[model samples]
Target: MATPPKPTKRRTYDAAFRAEALRLASESRSTQAAARALNINVKLLYKWQKAVQTPVAAALGASLDPTTAAELRQLRATNRRQAQELEILKKAIAIFSKTDEQ
Candidate 1:
């Protein structure tokens, strides 16, 4: 029998490296300059900046400061709770549908 091919490995970055990248992106330096100084690609830095900025931009109309880390955490928590509620509703609907079919 032929052996199966090995799975490709995914690249994993260290937490410290990620933290440093975020720190550099958060600084006042230009994305290109920060990426060059951090030895990462400028495109990646731009991507990170977009990902961080987009949410804050969306949240800008809110009274709370979107740039604050605490606001981000609270938003994340609210999202998590809504997701959990959605999952519970899905399971309940499935159970009820099965019961109805019985």
Candidate 2:
């Protein structure tokens, strides 16, 4: 007797996750690379990109001026660098303290 085929489950993402995924896609070199990193289909990422290109979504993004966007990008880069430095300092402290205990 032939076995029954299993039903496929569709995964649904929330608005926040969708927004983050879109942002990641824009920052990545290619949509396909971003989709692969996020474990999602490239077509789906393209769909989201199309949706965001609509008038309503475009208007929302238009609220930020080019200068403001550039400033925000710089600030985010600095913040990321500082966060990494903080993590390295924390690890160094742990190692130094461990050695002092000997």
Score every model by TM-score: 0.40, 0.53
1-102, model 2: which lDDT tens digit per residue? 999999999999999989889889877888999999999999999999888674654666768766876676678779989999999999999999999999
Clashes of each: 0, 0
Q: Give RMSD to native, each candidate.
A: 9.7, 8.0
lDDT (CA) per prediction: 0.73, 0.86
lDDT of 1 by residue, 27-94 (tens): 63576787888877787766665665556565663465536755665687699899999999999999
- Model 1 scores a TM of 0.40
Candidate 2 weakest lDDT stretch, 10 residues? 52-61
Off by over 4 Å in 2: 55-102
